[model samples]
Target: MMELQKASNGIFHDAAVEGGIPPEEEKFLQHKDDGSKRPEFTDFEGKTSFGMSVFNLSNAIMGSGILGLSYAMSNTGIVLFLILLTCIACLSCYSIHLLLRSAGVIGIRAYEQLGLRAFGQPGKILAAIVITLHNIGAMSSYLFIVKYELPLVIQAFLGLTSASEDWFMNGNYLIIIVTICIILPLATMKHLGYLGYTSGFSLSCMVFFLSAVIYKKFNISCPLETYGNHSVSTVTSDDTCTPKYFTVNQETAYTIPILAFAFVCHPEVLPIYTELRNPTKRRMQNIGNVSILGMFTMYFFTAIFGYLTFFGYTEAELLHTYSKVNPLDKLILCVRLAVLVAVTLTVPVVLFPIRRALLQLLFPGKSFHWVRHIAIAVCLLFAVNLLVIFVPNIRDIFGISGATTAPTLIFILPGLFYIRIVPKTQEPMSSRPKIQAACFSALGFIFMIMSLTFIGIDWMSGEMRSLGGH
Candidate 1:
């Protein structure tokens, strides 16, 4: 047990070595800090700040999910979407609360490790499998964005014809180039702390996207064709202009699932907690709060404005809806580039958790080694790029994975882990926290079954359902 703790310390020890501390001393220091502070402190004092942790976690939560949100809003209506989004956000926070509490009680920081502590090897393997699938969905989805959008951005910048068959315009080749030049370097980093700046920059791009969405709402007045002329060509009646407060349509079945997976950052949570500076359960939980709140605001505004601009005509991908106005429109082109960059940079942030889960499951006794790290990153990228390029129906992968894995990460695993890891003597089965956790786990089961049922019905009806075209 003590040896495993040392190996875990070694996994995160790359940054800690710069202080001139020997490996033995570092191991001893980790041991001292393990359970010495309080049961609340799940992590040691590292260099990552509160703001940076928020950025990393926030970046994880924000993804292709944002691109499809306005579409979700369009189907569910403004009022109903807000109600659903609020519930998902609050539930995500409570889910994080459950994880932090479970980790504090057990002093087990890795998600897989928590599973191991709870239900032995089978539990740990369950977590590892979930993370591998979930992040693979995430990383491929990001590259999927790059694969589809990079060519368009390149062509827009180069003033080339959209149908041009130039190598530079080939999305397959462009994804390869981006993977080699940009994502590979970032994903190979030893710790999540290093990606903070990239995360912040990625987030800044999304803010620009949000600003553009809001600006275009009033600027691109309805009878939406005027978006091409940049002038108000049609002054329609109030009925057409006013927002829909509530509506029910066939697409409504997929809206909640779309919004639900938007917050699937649970895999990244404990990894960030491990790298956090002076992390306590309360402090880490606060980080989750601020990040989720920021994204909630960004998601709501982006949806509301994008919906207002197009209303009922909004497409599955909001940017594509804008493309109808003018695909070559310069501002929309830049907006496409912004979304592309945001998701591209997000690929690396998603990689860390997957790498960690693989390491724990595959090389539990091995100390951190650069060869292992680089090999995993390179291999992971290669396979994901292949998946993105070769697979025409990548959304099915995301749809099935998102439907099953999102709820498991957000609700099921954390709730079950809390129940199993916390001692029955300390927190009795009938206690408030325990009762709440059991209910939470049960809710996860219900959500999973409901999502699958709706998705199955959609498929049976010959309407394929995917979360935001991922």
Candidate 2:
């Protein structure tokens, strides 16, 4: 059985077949200079294990989104949030099924190519644009973390007060420095396959982060609030620690988008599938399911513990709230460093997709060039750093990207691709699969409009308050 599996999936040059051409090398098949020439699937093999694939996919799922979930939980209440979360997770898993099914019928593994195969140039362009925007948002949010936490981490390490007026204390300047010194160099590397292993390490860091949040919940007292310069704790008998089961407000609209943003791992699914040894649909689907489930547990615990720690006082970025306990505390400081390192290292990997999407958009049918690669990375970092420096809050990034980009990738594109790519002979238009695909795409549109309306209302409310104050 092992030998047969190896012969089929391993490197072969005889003919185009499953498991031979990796998604990455799909570039070779793109060369179309001669009309009579048929593209060949280059000989390639994948060595990613089921366990490593799960970790990598989960690493993709869990990101800057976790930091804001407690705030989401705060607005939506515990019960409603869990219900929403469970539904979203399941929908995301189903979305992966749609993608795999689409890719299987036609041996197109790249997301944009699936789009192209499904609906021609427009579809491919749409997929590229959505992936670009989604990844740009991801990179911006990761840098946003750098902007928010790095300065604080620096101050803590130096044992400086919040009043310290040093240039290193400024987040804007520090983000620029870090981008040049760390993120840019890493992003310029030729091959990022080695960086895949960092996913496991990054996952471990978040686990440590979860552990710390849980520890603080029990070890720290209630009514913890930061005054002008110090933390003040007042234990009162009447202070309630009860969790809210349901909540409503303008801010509640951000919850779904945030959840969507957190679960936007669909882009990584096909590439991982192409890299699996046996590469069965069920095998890859199981990997995705386990990855999403693992992340779901971690996110729920982090939000719950962080929310319980501060309750109504929970901020959009969960890590920021911790400094109130003591920015200089040894444990908190270490967690900050771990998070900072994980995100910084991740910036390069995250940047890889965005650059690839840009290549498909701008330089199609062209071979690799160092100039394009380096220019995109530099330009991306420059633009993202500006966004991090100028953006008012990370929540805005989560809300906007989740509403628009997340749904496009997670729901709309997959559904449309499945409907178009899968043959009518295999599944009629009236079949359950096709019906579900249509409904799923429609749901994405509905989610977009609903989220936008609520966010617009929230914005108007804030504007009115400002005008009234003036």
Candidate 3:
């Protein structure tokens, strides 16, 4: 054991040297602040301010997932949607609190590290796999937005007639160019601390999107025209314009998973917590509250206005509902551009956690290495771009990813870690923490099963439709 520890320290020293860890700080990278030999805290320090950390985290939570939320609302109706959204938001905040509390008790700053302290090697690997898969799904969603929306923006800007057949209008080609020119550079960054400005900008763009939805909801008369048909419209009288207050069916089960996806900043939480200046469990929890609350407000308004505007007619992607509106309308066009840019900037933020998870799993004791970092970023972005190009349905990706990974990250893991790490003396099986953990885990399991069931039913139905068409 002693010899193995020394070997791991040696690897850390070498990686730190290559990655530019200051020589004086190199010793700090070999052990914890408590003078323990744990590899978790070696060389990591918090540099992000409270406000900036909130912005980064909120950016992480808010992604292309918001676009599908109106659809989720459509399934659940206005009243149930708000109820579920509020419940999910509260549960998300509570789970994050559990994680931060566990990390505080253990003095660990990384999710995999927390897993390591909790369940040894297997736990670490599980955490890493979950983070990698979840973030990859998230990155794909962002790219999906880029792939679908960028071409429309280009066509609008160029004033291209529908008859025009320009190569530049191709979504696949545009995604490649955008990935190479924009996403690649952002994703290759070695630290999350440097992304604060971009994250803030991304949040601002989302706010613009929310504002646009509200403006159009009131300004545009209903019933809105379907895409490509100005002559025919879904007329909404004042009476019919009011949203359905409550409804439930098989579709309602799917909304839970979509709400889970909307609030999934869990993978990115630990990394941000690590970089937060004056970090403490309480401070980190505050950041989580501010971020989640801000997003909750934005999400609620966006969904309400969007659902009210089109009511029963809201599409899966809220932006698509606007297709019938004059594509050349400057305000609507600006909203699309804002959403595109928001999701574009979000790709790098989501990419950071996946890269960290990969490094923690593959090179456990190593410090940051630019070559490895850039290579991983490039490869991950390439893979996600491919999914965006080929995967025609973002909804399926969102459903599966949210169903499988979000619940684990949000509910199961946090609850499990708290149960494992909190001392038996402090938190016995009958204690509130343990009880909460048990309930949270149970809820997560149930959620996962239901979400998968709904997704399976939807998939089979889709297949039958395709066959029927053939």
Q: What would the per-residue lDDT of candidate 2 be over residues 352-470, giving only the tens digit for each residue?
A: 66776676667664555778779999999988887788778655555566567777888899999989877776678999999999999999998778767766776877741110000
lDDT of 1 by residue, 1-470 (tens): 22323224444432111123234333433432234465433233356899999999999999887878888887888999999999999999999998987776656577887787678788889999999998998898888888878887887788875548888888899999999999999999877888999999999999999998998887775667644444433445566666888979978877877888888899999999987877777889999999999999999999999999987667778888787776667888888898888998999999999998898888774557999999999999999999998999887667778778888999899999989877776678999989999999998888889888887887898887675522
Clash pairs for candidate 1? none
| Candidate 1, backbone clash total | 0
Candidate number that wins on lDDT, 1 or 2: 1
TM-score of each: 0.90, 0.82, 0.86
Ranking by lDDT: 1, 3, 2
2 or 3, greater by TM-score: 3
What range of 10 consecutive residues in model 3 has the weakest lDDT sum? 1-10
Task: Give Cα-based local distance difference scores for all models.
Answer: 0.81, 0.73, 0.75
Best lDDT among the predictions, by candidate number: 1
What does candidate 3's lDDT look like per residue over 1-470, in tens digits? 11112222222221122122233333433333342333333335666899889989999988776877787787788888889899989998999988877775655567887787678778889999989888887777667667767887888887875634677878888888989998888887766867888899989988989988988887776666544544435554565556777878766665677786678899889889877776667788999999999999999989888888877677777887776665557888898899888888888898888988888888866755779989999999888878887877655655576678877898899999989876676668999879988899889998788777776786878641100000
lDDT of 2: 0.73
Model 1 residue runs over 4 Å out of place are: 1-37, 40-45, 226-239
